[model samples]
Target: MNEIDILKKIASNLTERKSTAALSNYEVLCNNIAFSHDLFEKGIVYLEFIIDHLKSIFNDRLSLKGDFRENECLHPFISVIPSLLLNDLEVIKKLSAYTPPDNRHGITIDNVSLLHRGFMNYNNLATATRQLIDSLVTDSYQLQLLDPKEFNYHVLLSLNSFEKYATKSIRQGLFNQEIEDALLEFRKLNFKDWKNSSITKCQHITFSNKVDHLFTNLNLVASEDIKFKNEINNLFKFSSEFTHIGYISTFFTSQAGSQVVFGSEKSPYLPSTENFSELKYQILETCINFIHKVYLPSLSSCVSKIFSSSQELVIEKHISNLVSLLKEGIKTRNNSYYFFVCSSLIGSQRIIDLPCLCGHLNKWRPPHSNSDLFCTGCGSSYNILAIEGDPGYIITGNGPVKVIGSEAPDFQDLPKEKQQEMLIKVAEFNANGSGN
Candidate 1:
């Protein structure tokens, strides 16, 4: 049957209360239109019309089941329609002020509650769509329009809180010294068992699946937008260098008993913490722009074509309100969460050391030494067996300063005295350096 005729028949069935036949027709319509973007958009309009009609018919009749399925014929129709409506409503609410006049229009709370049990069904549907999109991207479906670079960038940005927290932990010395030492122990762990660890395996599987899905979608839409294609290609290059090659190099170097050189010559695109933060901000801005300039407008245009001309203003206003709300929501939500996580990870500990001008007797040690005799606070090295008892040494390198144990005082019980002595030494070092 023609689309208009089929829609008319479905509406008639609803009016006549022929639930069985109406549902069957609805199911057929839904199934046929499910994959076609154009058909899906039209179907939503038809469903919205049917919902309004049903509300008008049964508004005073309290006998109808509260479930969406009672009025809708198909299972998927009942399941999906409420969410679409709610999603539409949420976008509207977000875009527009819940001011009294606008609030007075559209479905009332009482009706909405009775229809979908108080919860907006659209959120569930949007979540489902997100999941489906994720799955499609992971499966490498060429027909999908998603860009993995943009998608991954979004996901990483979403996890900004996690990254911030991790960095904070490093800066604050929050980790136990023993835990830091455990790196040596971790190296000795069996490779077979380590490789098969649940976390590692799961991460590998998830990443691989996502990459596959992303590539498939990329291939399908490669010809649609040259800019998008170029972005995707750059993203792939970054991922290859940052994740694949960088990870391999780190693993081998760490295993080889050497420091892993991160963000090195081989992986030029791998961002440092500062770089990652900046890139994340840029990506978020770009996504927001894309959504505002491209996605929302395109969807609105399609919606306008399907709906009544008179309703255009209302729909457009609703969409604008929603886009604004989403932008604000993302910013507020991410900022607060990111700050909390990062602060927790990187505490407020300040590291202080003696300046070079201090002429305090300073003991020095070779750049590479294994001893707990270094006082990080004063940048002094101590030797217990010096002829004068304890000889203090000061670091004199352009790199990070380290304390040597030989220069530290043996007066453990005289904490105040030891601090006073260190201050005097610092004064002398400073004076001598100033003269030169």
Candidate 2:
């Protein structure tokens, strides 16, 4: 129907349902649509940023419109975001809101409960999608200022999270019916059937067989978006590089030297401004194409399938506010990420036993030697070493020991008196085998 007619129908429907719970259902459905729309807005901001960044880089280089070198840099984020967004939309579609037209066809308690389950799945997908969009924004900024190659690693991790949620949603949808059927099969039994046991077994067997049939038919329920499906298939193939060693792995690794060359001697590897401009062009093209052709449809389809035209009109009333809130949220959440890696030699470390305050011997180890050295016996957070008495070293059998590991804090790091006090306590503990 035309826009005017659709609005009229929506108005009529709302007036007709003024006193009915369908109005409330429509309201709730609009909220869910708004929530998904908020994520879409955030994602759009990232895409626009990438597009703008590309324009700035390539605006001066019209001569290099079609250069293809270094295009690999743009591939990960380009394919990853759209694929993940499409998957998220599909999960949302599974929970399409239902409002029966008449009393005879109204939603049942079971349907309401099932819808709740679907909402839970959609909520998880939405959160994970937001995290990915946030990561992409952060990565995009970092790419400009730091290592551009790090973008792929961040995208790969986000893809892992997105895939994890998508798999969970699929499993939840797939097994929900089987679980209900299994319960129904159990309920349809008498005392005699229970005593027979074989009847119960047969029921379970039938349910198992049906599950197999459902698995075979699952492909029929797959997303109708061919590009989405193709992207998902391609994504899964390339995602393995993050988990295993291969070519994509090398994309993030530092080169041996700037002088290293590849391919022909005549062409001897050198960075060109044209190639860089082409890379920017590729980024721009991919982001624009995906945003228009893939992301917009996916978001529109999600909202379209879940809400009626009347409810959509209601959502439109708040679209401006949603967009503003999305912008505020993105601005607040745009912060740099700091991460640390442990490269110390873990093999040479000795597992020192220390007494816990709780009178357990397995509790404390010196700081930073092993983070995982919690007490398994007493469940204490760490092993506590209790040192008592005068500020002098109590001699061990072989010698006076001040510290254990070289990585341990320097004795001079503490005040001279405090260092002597700690050493005396350690020596006392060594001599008596107990501080308390």
Candidate 3:
């Protein structure tokens, strides 16, 4: 059956017998799906923001006066976001297909298999979310701090560090002799003295290193809070279980009352189903906070650092939306959710039907100061550019949606520099023919 039909079939049966846990799998799945569903929307905006800002930076710097390393540094980030997003959507889909063990069958072998798959998917989701955290916070730190050559080299070393694992893997005949010979040849060809090169011995700057350097690079108030590091470390520790174990999260589309089957380890006391929902929510909340409290500030600083030589605001125009969103988030986070309606008290509202990309009319009144304009229809809010006589325009991140798969091939699959070459080719082709 098709995925939607399968999901419908699965979700159409959440009703339960008396033997299940305190919360029925139906209710537990509902809460988790609802949480992840909301997160999916937030995650999209967050990823889009990153890609959009990256687009601004890439397009602006792609034509720089000198050095190919600038583009090289950017290449890793291009594929990573799209890949994570694909995983995110998939996790939610799998979760939607979730159902608890049918106690009516007394936890049969089939039910055990079902539960095992559910938890496994949950772990995968956790790991993917953790990876997303790095893409947003840790990766942004590198972009804003390191020079292009240094950053690109770090990524290269990380990607090409198969030598160490292979050479000393301790797994008997992990690689065939032919592959072994190829690896040796590859290292010899690339690194003249693979055995003695100091650069080869050096470790890439890790997420913790990036976090450590975040404050040193920029003097933000949260720099001294110490909680960002603690939270991120804790998040990694939690996801490490799932990342290695390969278990995990789910899709949001489900009907109430579906009988679900899940596997669990035998224990003195079974853990409550509520725990996963809370944990997933907490991780996502932490991700959002890191983006706002850490990445955005670091990114703004990076933009200035990067364009320090230029006089005009080449990339800031595109990035200002992110800063604006951060500002709005900080402004309203502590206050009431309905404070925006109260905002109309202080500033006059403009009734314009400037169409939003969400297919909703943007007739809502914006703040008099032209800060961030939030579309009520799609809830996609960003900084509204207030130009004279131009009723302001929406700069939807407008980053390439299919950069990895359909447009230029997956960046991860490409060899060093080939992704960049293919990307430019795709850009050129799309530019000439209007991306038909």
TM-score of each: 0.23, 0.21, 0.45
C-alpha lDDT of residue 320 in model 2: 27
Error of 3 at 246 (Å): 10
Candidate 1 residue spans exceeding 4 A from truth:
1-225, 232-271, 320-436
Q: Which residue pairs in candidate 2 collide?
A: 363-382, 363-383, 364-383, 364-384
Mind giving the per-residue lDDT tens digits that candidate 3 earns over 215-269?
5565543644576677786787677666666322222112123333444332111
For residues 149-176, what per-residue lDDT tens digits would candidate 2 score against the true structure?
3433333334434445566667566456
Candidate 1, residue 383: CA error in Å? 61
Report the lDDT of model 1 for residue 360: 26
Highest-scoring model, TM-score:
3
Instruction: Identify the superior model by lDDT, candidate 1 or candidate 3.
Output: 3
What is the clash count for each candidate, in the order shown? 39, 4, 33
What value of lDDT does candidate 1 attain over all alpha carbons?
A: 0.32
Local accuracy by lDDT, each model: 0.32, 0.33, 0.44
Residue lDDT tens for model 1, 269-334: 111222222332333333333343334444454334333444445455545443443333333321
lDDT, residue 386, candidate 3? 28
